[model samples]
Each structure stands twice: as C-alpha cells, then as structure tokens.
Target: MEEHEKDLEDVPDMNKKNSIIESGEAMDQLITIDGEERITSHNEFEPVPLTNNLNADELDPETTAKLRGDAIGDTLYSQSFVLKTLLKFADLNWNQQFEEDLCFLWDMTAEKSVCEYLWELSFPSVACGAVAKYTENRFIEIVIGTLANVLCVGCDKTMTKEEIGVIIQELDSDDHLVLIQVMRFISSVAFSSSETPFIDEEAMNRLCFVLNNSINTELLLKTLETTAKLTVDFKLDKNLVNSSLYNAVLTAYCTLLGSAYLELDTKDGILACRYMLENVTNICGYIDRFENATLKLDITENLDGFLQEAIKIIKYLSQEENLLPVTDDTIFFMSAFQYIFINLNVNYSPEIFIAISKILYIVSEIRNEVERLFESTLELECFLISRSTKQRIFKDLKLLSKHKRKTVLDVVLENGPKFHFAFDLKDLKDEVT
Candidate 1:
C-alpha cells in the first residue's frame, strides 16, 4: 500500500475527460474564456485522494525490479499480494473484501507506473474476467472503473485485440450505473489505447440502442461521450457510420429537449426532466445525486463535433464528396440537416433552451466552414440567460444577440419560430467587443 494520495497533477486525466460531477448546488457560471480565471470543473465533489488500502508483504525485491517496479514499486511485493487476493475473490462477486480490493486496485491503477506494472502482471486479464463474471451492480461498476483506469492511462497500444473483444461483448446491459461506467470505460480505454478499436457488432448495436432509445441522462451522456471518443481520440469514423448512430445524433436534441417521444426502460425509467439542465439540476441537487452533466456539457461539444468529424471521415474515405460540396441535401449529411430544419419550429423552454441552441449551433457549424464544429462557444452559455453567467462562460455565444456570424439567436429570431426565453438573450452582451 502506498503512503500518499496523488496531487491532482498525478491523477489520470482519463476520468476527467468529457465529464463533470454533479455538484448539487446551483451557482451562477460566470466566464470569459479569454480573461476569466479558469473554471474548475467541479461544482460537485472534490477529486478523490487516490491511494490503495492494501498493506501486504512484498513478493520479493528482486522480482519487483525485474517487473519495472523499482521506482514506483519499491513496494511492488505488496501489490502482488493484492493481485493474488483479487483473483481469489473474482468469482465471489460482491463480498466486502472483494469490493475493498477492487477499490484499492482502481486507486492504484490511477498512477501510470503502477498501471503498467499491473498490466504486465495480467491485471487487465483479471479485470476483464471480473467484468464478465460480476453480476452485482456495485462490483460491475468498480471493476469496470478499475479496468478503464488500467487500460486508458495513456494511448493504449499495449492492449491486445482479444481483451477489447471481451469488454465489447459485455456491454449489453439493463443497468444504468453499469452501462454508464462501461461507456466511460470504452471511451477512455478502448478508443484512446487502441490503434484500431475493436468493437464487435453486438457492442456497437448495444451502444446504438443506448444512444437512440435510453432516457437515462447519465447513461446517454456517457454514450455520447463514447461517440466523441471514437471520433476525436481514435480518429475512427468507421465505428460511427451506423445509420442509427447518425440519426441518434441528429434527433438527440429532440429527445433530450423533450421535443420527441423517448422509449423508457422499466428498470431505471426517467421523466422528461432527466435531460433538461434545469430539471436535472433540481432533482440531482436533492441529497447526494449521481446525475451525468454530460448531456448539458459534454454532449454540448461532442454532438456536433462527432457529426462534423464523421462527415469529414466520410468524405476522406469515400473520396466522392470532395468533388461535390457537402450540403443539406447531400446523402451523408441529410440526417443532420433534416433533424435541424425539421426541429427549427419546435418551441423550447428556457432552462433547457440550450438544446435548441445546441441544434441550431450544429446547423451553423455544418453550414459554415465546419472549422470548429465542437468549438462549443455555446456550451458554457447553456441553461443560462443571466447577464453574469453569459460573461463567465465567455465564448462567441455572448455575441449571439448582436447576430455575430449570424449566431444561433439570430437564426431563431429571423426564422420567426416559437422559442422560450429565460431572459432577454440580447442582454447577454460582451461589453469588450
């Protein structure tokens, strides 16, 4: 067992990607991306003090150095004992000791040196087995979390193709918590670590199912993050070419905004408010909440970015669209264009008004240079109409009222479509410009 928790810098950025904890209080977000102090991601819990609790006897100092543990693992023998104990309890599922060991492993794996040593020791094999064998919600969540921390510490070129197949096979699930962690795992580990991510058809289908149908906001957010990870991190567009996936991204704004019917799973059904920033905020603020801020934040950036990347991939791969300008009528882009134009007339509520802005921003992104589809000038502006909140998350969104670049607000106003305002968006002015 290590005597120290890592400084935040020592912590793996894997868990920090495209997600924010649900910090239950509602505080005003004030931002000026250029001038504002850096907005720390947590309005929620502080980062965990990452350290393992195991204090077992060392296997041997000689053996530890042979396994590249000399610097980080002067105490590698203690880790060996922890690993052996973890295997012993793998099939035991959710026993208290097994859970404790799993948490320790997850904490230990957060350090890259420890993670690499454990990988060489076949901890990843142990983890994948547990991921398949564990049925209880708690164990499945922790083990998947551990596996993600292990595999995704850096670009994961070390993992074999077979290991990814096992995880991809296990992704079909009815539990939101299990699904959420697994989605995070895939996005963080499989996509970043692999030269070419190996997703089986079943896993891809399950992901599409989650994306197209699920109402669970946390799960949906994670699923969207997975799409972003594939497109952004791996640069793998073939994985995202599913028609269902494209349609899901297109109609996602409608589903999340409550502008369309969503299928519910009885196991963890959600009300319409689950996807709304305001509703989720109100509900999650109740006691300790585990809501995903992804829908409000991550999806804000990923959704459009994913689509734009997919389009670029399609053009580059097919070598056909470069000859013809990609347009609203182009076969590949029709899904996104259709979703945007069709939903243009739908009225949106203020707290969730960001949904419309998101979709409209998507349209503006695709139609223009497609330069920064995921630029997210509007992400910080989400769920806010306050003059102060506007300046805090400062991006080009502040100039929307003045119709800068003919921003989203400009399009909505000029179209004369029904829109709900939390406040006068025109007042969300950037004084500097």
Candidate 2:
C-alpha cells in the first residue's frame, strides 16, 4: 500500500490510544509482560510517526489535490496494522488494559476518514469486562482528560460545522460511551484557554440532530450534563451557545424527566436537573464576577429578567401536579431555587429579590393547597430567610442579624405561617433581609 494509505490508518488508531492510555495509572504503568509483544524500547514508545514517511513529492498532481481522501486512507492503513499488533499482544488477564487499548483503538478509528470504521471495528463485548477489570476512579478521570485533549487536537480547529456533522453522523456507532467522549470534547473546547478554535458551524448545528437521532439514554444524560456545563461556561449568550444545540439539550432533559417521573431510576432525571441548576447559578454569578463597573451595571439592570426565566424553569420542575408523589425533581427545583435566591440576596440585589418574592407570593395566592404542600420542604424557608426582606426572619435567623429588612420583607414575612409550615427545618439565615 502507498504511504498515504498507511497514514489514514494511524488517525483512527488514536481512539485506541485514548482508551488504553486513559484507563489510568495501571494502564499507564503497563510494560510488556513477555513474548513477541515485549517492548524493545522501554524508554521510547513514540507513535511510529506516519508524517515522516508520507512524502508529498511522491504524490502525483491529481492525487495531491485530493488531500482529504489521501490523508484518510493513509491513516486507516496505519491504524489497521497497529490494531493487529495491539490485539495480538493484549493480555486477557489484565482486562482493564485490554479494554483501554480497545477504546483507544476506537478513538483512533473514529478520527480516520473512514466513516464505516466504527461499525467495522467496534470493540467486541468480550473485551468490555477486561477493560474495566481494574477500574479506579482517579485513573478514569485522567484517562478521560487525556482522551479529551486528543479529540480536541484531532478535530483540527479548522473543521467546518458541516464537516463535523458529517463525521459525527457517520461515526461507527451511536454508542453511549462514544457520545460521552465527544460531548467532553465540546465542553473542553468551549472552556479551553487557548484561543477558541474555529469549529465547523455546520458540524455544531448537527448536534441536535445527532442527539435526537440517538437511542441511548446514558449518552443523552451525559450530553445533557455537558450541555448544562457549556451553558454556564458560555454564559448562555446566544452567539456563544448555539440555539439548536441548547434547545435540543433542554428538550432531552425535559424528556428524561417526563419518562422517568414515576420510574425507579428517576435519579438520572434528578441529576440532570441539578446540572441545569448549576449552569443557571454560573450564569448568574458571571454577572457579578465581571469587574467593569459599566458592564456590572448592565448585567445587574437586567438581572431580574434572567432570574425570572430561571425561576420559570424551576417552577416547571417544582410543579407537583406534573408528577406522581412529587419526585426528587420537585425537591431539586426547591433546592436550586432556594440556592439561587440566596445568592441574589447575599449579593444585595433588592430588585431581583423583590421580583422573586413577588413571584412566590403570586404562587402562594394561586395555589391555595400548594403552600401547605411544600411546607415540609426545608429549602423554601431557607430561601425566604436568606433573602428575608421579612423582619421576623432577619430578627430570628442568627445569620441575618446584621442584615436589615425593608417593608417589603415585612409584608411578605407577615404571612409566614402559610410559607413556614412547609419547611423541612428552621430558617438557615439570621435575618430575613
């Protein structure tokens, strides 16, 4: 085979590198045990460099024009040889190493121009048990981090969104783990300190398509988590956060909540919601973190609007009527709302706090039985006292002793019995203001 074809093979082999190398220290410390597989160079395990062998001068003009095709073909051919060597030398007893190797191979395979490679070279189930054999949490994190870096580099900052879409669609499998890795790449790139790489818009636009097309809930859950994180990292700016991608993620989270509402595995739904909550907090915090006085004023001026939308989302989740037995989703909504409100209050955003108080007061009035309903939910009282504009909460809550309450706090807290009955504990704050 020509040298270019060999290069194509090496690209996809990166996946295997990711899987094996990422399995943590055990796999990291792996040394050839014996046999034909024994390492000849103990100190130098460099990737058999493919670039050095591919001489551009050797390619005819016609072939040189087809850089994409030639590059892919070469990568595939090179990886094929590596796969064989790895499979042969693999130790069945050290399954973790084996699995890591297989996953690494998959990562590499997916990087190739061969769209069909994923289906063709998927790691067999037999290898699964072996790969996870010696799993350690810390090792898993390191391996994942390493794999994320490889993907970021391999994606070649220049890939158009369209190209990325095509590649993702043609990926070997709609595998849950594979999607998780991809999502990890997206999150990392968004937050990476290096200048933001040029990502193919066409490729990113396809995120919703890929997500909607997928059947794996585990993948969906992880995707949701990653999306939530991105929303925070990107501050939910429309330009920074793709609307299609964002909506698709929110839709998925809502879907999970709906499907698992009554199921035993609702924890997945709860966890997904928690992720969303954190993002909201991060976004809100960003407004405060900015040092520019003018920028800060601008953010603060519109803080009420942002908080309102977030409250609406929380309100949806907290709606007891939406589910049976009022799930952890409900509790999570309360907790998240309580936490967010506390932040706004401590930061002394009276405008935003009063806005929230107004909304909760409206809810209290409309949902007559609702007040009695969540009376045992400790989060409600914590939020009220934390932002206590109410005199009682300020006077009673040890934490609120230094804070003062306006008349608005009094008006709201005066009807304390209606709200207090539902709390899980005494107010966490010293004062209502």
Candidate 3:
C-alpha cells in the first residue's frame, strides 16, 4: 500500500514537470512567431509587441488614398477631380458646399504642379461652365472669384487663348449675372499681366456689345472699367478704337453720357458719369500713345478721327444743361474735368486744343470757375510753348473769346502764361485786333 502511494506521488511530479515544459515552449513560440511575449498567471510579465501593419479600413478613403499617394510621392487629389466635383455640386445648387471645396482647391492651385494640372483640365472652361450653369449669383461669384484669385496670384500659365476665347463667347449670354461675372473675370485676367494673351479684338467687341446693350447699370460700369484697363495696352486700344466695334463703343459712351447728364442728381447717374469720364480718359491716354506711334510712322489721319470722338464726348459732358447746376458741390463733374485735363494733351491735335478751349469757355461761363479753367489752360499753354516754341496760346485764347461771350481767356490773359517766358501780349493784342 505504501509503495502504491509513492508511485502516485511520483506520477504527479512528472506530470507537473511536463506541463511546465509545454508552457515554456508555448511562450517561446509566441515570442518567435507573433512577436509578443506571453505572461504567466503567477506574477510574471512580458514586453509589449511592436506592430508593422495598420488596419487601413480604420481610415477614410481620402486619407487612405492620400497615404498611398504620398508613399508614391504624387498628388492624390487631382484638379479634374476637384473641378468635376464642383461642377456636380453647382448643378445641384449645393452652393455653400461647392464654395467651400472650391476655395480649398483654389488654394491648392498655388502649387506649380496643381496649376499645371488645372491648365491641363482647362480651368477657364470650368469657370465659364459654372457661370453659365448656375443662375445663383453667389455660385457664379465663387467660381469666378476663384479664377480671379488664381490669376491674380500669377497662375496665369493656366490661361490659354482657347480658354479666353471660350470666355469671350460666353459674353453674349443674355443673363446679366453671367455677363457681369464674365466681365469681372476678364478684367481680372487682363489685369493679371501685361503680356496676357486674352486681349484681342474679338474680346473687345464682345465687351462693347455688353456696353451697348445696357445690360444693367452696374454691369455697364463694370464693362466700361474693363474696357479702360484693356485700353491701357496701346496696341490693343488702337486696334479696338479703329475696329468696327469702335462705333458701338462710342455710341454706348454717348448713351451713357446723355443718361448720366439727364439723371445727374442721382447716385447711379453720378457713378455712370464718373465711369464714362474715366473711360474717356483711358481713351485719351491711348490716343496720346497712338499719336506717338503715328508720329514715328508720319501718319495723322486716324488721329483726327480719334480727336473728333473726344470732342463729341467733351461737348456732351459740357452741354449747358449738364453744367448749369455746377456748384462747389458738383464733385463728379469737377473730377471729370480734372481727369480730362490731366489726360488730354492738346498739343497732339489742333482739334483737341480747340475742343478743350471751347469746353473751358463753357465751364468758365456756367460756374464762373475761371481760375480753375485758367490754371488748366495755362498748363496746356506751357506744354504747347515747350513743345511748339511758339506763342500760339494767345491766338487760341482769342478764338475761345470769339466763341463764348464770357470766356476763360480773361482768366488766362490775367495769369499771362505763367509757364512761358517769350509770351508777348502784342501777338495776343494783334490776334484780338
């Protein structure tokens, strides 16, 4: 009985030893295969494992794709994708969300690679499409505003002649909202660079069409403002004024001036007047440059026609009704006169000189603002004296007196050519006699 008890105890000891060996082997397998150490229930611990793999399903698709694309070092989000998404959202009238995403992508376009991608996708086409598709002003503004921001930041490499042509074609859309945005977009593009490829006669003609149609007061003014910017390029301006569109542009200006003068007391009317005057000043600057070019070519015929247009504009603006209520408070008209005086150098054309003199005479008679007119005239006389070296200003003064009963000539004769030295009143006295 004792021997049997000893065998049983020996059996328990052997079994315990085998169990411990198995447990150690299991722990070794865990460490070598799973890279995780196993812990014992008996107050023993093991080190935590390091992981090499992540469950990608935990991340969103965009993040996953971004990670994958970043691993490969290429852009994960494409301009086309962004543009398509925007187009889809715009079509659905999801404007707020569209703008949010659009601004994000627009910011991305600052990257050269992204800008190149946008060029590849033809961003202008997308912009025009958005403008044409969405009747919502804010949506159109977002799309166009994005484009303008891009251009303003010098992402003009995305600009192409084909894209510009597409924008120009959209200018005829009867939708004023679309038209206004298109003008704003074009203005932004043109102002982006002096070497912009978008300044063409067709573009100018389209702009003139907008001006002539009288789409809206704001639209007309905006179009006029863009036209003024475009005319800053002398070649473009000369081509524009000499094109078939010139008549349309001039008619629009005439209509604007007439309307402005008739509605002078109103705010819109005053803005319209100021815009037209600014446009005229731009045209005058173009004329000055054109004259310089023509002088080199020894040509003067086109200049005469341009001067006649200037006279017509000045005459309309200086009409008795337009100037009769001219008080110290007539800010826009005074500003218009100042702009014309600053921009229109009469030494370029005899007709312009005569027109300026006549306009000054009218202004002096109406407001008795002779001192202001005299200062302007003396400035012109000084420019003429320096350039022509002839005291012909007194002759102009005499002619101006003959046309108007009360003239600025009295003011000029009193000032006596402050900027000229060889001015003898004898010549003036002879011309008067």
Candidate 4:
C-alpha cells in the first residue's frame, strides 16, 4: 500500500514535468515559425490554425464567377480540379499561382472566355500586387488585348453591368490598358444616352489616376467619353467629382478630337455639347452642396478649372465647322451647350454665355449642324421646359418664333427634305399630322 501511494505521488510529478517540456517545445516551435526571438506584447498569442478556419463548402456564386473568369486560358483541354478546389475553399494563398496560370492559359489559347474571365476578376486591382510578383509583361499583354476587344463590344450581349463592374473595379486599381478599358466601356455605354455604369469615387479615382498618366490618344479620348457619360448619367455634385481627373479627360478628349478631324455627317459638336450638358444639368444643386467646407474645398476647387476648360473646348468646337457623326451626338451637343451657357449665365459669367450664344447662331446655319443637330430640335425644345436652363432657350426661340430669322427659319423648313431623302417624308408627315 505504501509503494502504491509512492507511485501515485511520483505519477503527478512526472506528468507535470512532461507537460512543461512539451510546452517549452511548443513555444520554441512558435518562435522559430515566426522567425522572431523576442516575444512582443502584440505577438504573444498564436494565430488560429489555417486548416481550422477553412470552409469545406463551395464558394459563393459571385466569388466563383470571379475565380472562373480569372482562371481562363490556364487549361488547354482539361479543367484543374486542384485549382477549383482551392478557390472553392476561398483559400487566398493559392490566388497567386492561380492568376499566373490563368495568364498563361490566356496566352496559349487566345480564348475569349479566358480573357473575359480575367476581366471579371480584374486581376491587377484586387490581385495585382500578387500578380506583379508572378506575372510578366507578355502575359499582361494577352489580357489587355482581350479586354480591349471586350470593351468594344465583341461578344454576345449576355454581359451585364454587374459583370462589367467587377472587371472595372479591378481595372480602376492600375494605370494600364485595364484602366483604358474602363474608360472606353463607360464612354460607350453611358455617353450613348443617359445610362450610367457602376462608377463611384473609388472607381473614378482609379480611372482618373490612369487618365492623368496615360499618353495614348485613343485611350484618352475614350476616357473623356467616360467622364462625359458620368456627368450626364448621375445627379452628382460636379465639384465633388474628381475635378482634375474630369478636366484631364475632357482636355485630352478635345485635343484628340481636334487632332483627328474625324468627319461626321452628323453634327458631332452638338452631340458632344449635349453630352456635356447632360453631365452638368444640375450645377446649382451641386454648388449648393458645396456650402459645406468639407465638400466645397474638396469638390469645388476642381470644378472651377474643369468648367472653364469645358467652356473653352465648347467655344473652340462651336467656332469650327460642324460634323455630325451619329444623330444623337448633334442633339446631345446642342443640349450640352445650352446647359453650359446657362450654368455660366446663372453663375454670372457673361463672357462665356455670350460666346456660347454666338456658337448657337453658327450651329443653326452650318449645313452639318442643321442636318445633325435639328433631328430632335422639337424634343430639345420640350426638354428645355423641364430644365433650369429653360430661360436661356427663349433667346433662340424668340428669334425662331418672331423675326423669321433665316438661321432659325431655315432649320425649321429644311428639316424633312434632306432627312427623308431615303424615305417617304410626305407620307410620314401626313400620317403624323
């Protein structure tokens, strides 16, 4: 019995000693793993085991789409189970290898899906830092080519704004072709009408950074197109929007447009002007918001310059001969000019208002402007009723309605003869009347 009691006493001591030794080994292991000898207050606790926190289920659909899109061009004939499995678990550690593989496959196949997927992942933004570590220039080129094609609307119309937004978010993070792609896409979709992309400050900053740095003319024009679209699509605080970026895009676009001298059978200036107006329709509201210093200091300073630059571009274009590309461009420009002039007038910049009014007179006479800018003249008249700039239109209308001004009357009379050269205008008019 005494021997048994002695053994029990010894057992506890032995167990305690073993525990101490094991604990010491664990501490040593932690120190070695962390590659630090000094234990600091912040480093006292060990991290949760990676395996313990991993989810075993499939990734969310949005996440899966992002992964799949990014994985394109990686496989020649077979899908990678291991890659898919890692993504399924949301294992960020594997993203580097995955992006590398996707870029590789993108080069090998020239497959649209791969490029499309990469666009969706917007690899460089969210994954760019990691991607730069593993990727080379050649691979990035493949992705950029794919993005350029997609930006021009090459695929089936299945692509939606959400998918495009995912790609754009990534593009906004860098100042490369990805950034150009964002500009082109927004310009094409948003500037065509009042439609807007999924853009915000975060996205704009990324795009603006790219615009500020880019030298490519085509890409710069596309960026301008995007800025114009952004201005029109949303009711925004104009000053609050990235003023430097906006001005850069507009200046670049205007410079390129003049350099190209791309002729339009339609009144392209009016369209441009219209797009500009659409972008800044509610300057009063934007200015009112600037009453607060945080907004005014941050947002207003930029606008003063941008608005002046925009006025200069319009003034320059207004003086030049008109060329109409698409019909919308003309009508859009006319409306845009009206908005600019009014904004200037309301803000009491009479010189600018007078200069724009002179351009309106020129636009009314120019053959191209008449053809391109007149199609929706009636609609523009109606649009004026709803706008704060309605007071400015009375100047143009009074000339039209009263003096029988050749510039205005000719526009009203010449409308259908040239427009219906390819169609039966008389029959259509009779049907409408």
C-alpha TM-scores of all predictions:
0.46, 0.36, 0.48, 0.41
Per-residue lDDT of model 1, residues 1-433, tens digit only: 0001111112122222222222111111111123332211211112222323332345465654565443444433355655566767545745666656666565655445665677777876776776676566666666676666555444234556776666676576665555666775676553434344476555667777776676555556556656545543223434334435444643443444343333321111122212222111222222112233432233334344333433332233223233234432223232332232222221222323333344445545464553222222232223233323444424534433444424665543444323344444455433423
Tens-place lDDT digits, model 2, residues 1-433: 0000011111122233222112111111111222112111211222332223457778787766665342444452344544563464344333456445544443343332322232234322222222243333222333343334333333323334433332234223333344455555455445432333333454445555545554455455555555454455443443444334534654555554445332323455455566655554454455445532443444445455445445445445433344335444554555556655554543433333433443343344434455432432333443554443444433343322222223333434454544433332224222333
Candidate topping TM-score: 3
> Model 4, stretches more than 4 Å misplaced?
1-133, 147-175, 182-202, 227-232, 235-320, 323-328, 343-433
lDDT of 3 by residue, 1-433 (tens): 0000000000001111221001111101111215433321111122222232455558798878766653311344454556566557445646455656665564444333554555556666777666655555445544664565345334436556766666666665665544655665666665544654566666666777666666345556567656655555543536555434444454555555454333545555554555555555555556566664533222233334444545554555455565555543233444444444544434444445555555556655543554554345445533444444335554554555564512444545555454454555445555554
Cα shift from native, residue 382, model 4 (Å):
14
Task: Judge candidate 2 against the unseen true structure and give its global Cα lDDT, from 0 to 1.
Answer: 0.40
What lDDT score goes with residue 161 in model 4? Answer: 60
**Ranking, lDDT, top scorer first:** 3, 1, 2, 4
Model 4 CA lDDT for position 301? 47
Candidate 3 — worst ten consecutive residues by lDDT sum? 1-10
Once fitted onto the true fold, the runs of candidate 3 whose alpha carbons sit more than 4 angstroms away are 1-142, 149-158, 235-238, 243-245, 260-262, 265-267, 284-375, 380-433
Best by lDDT: 3
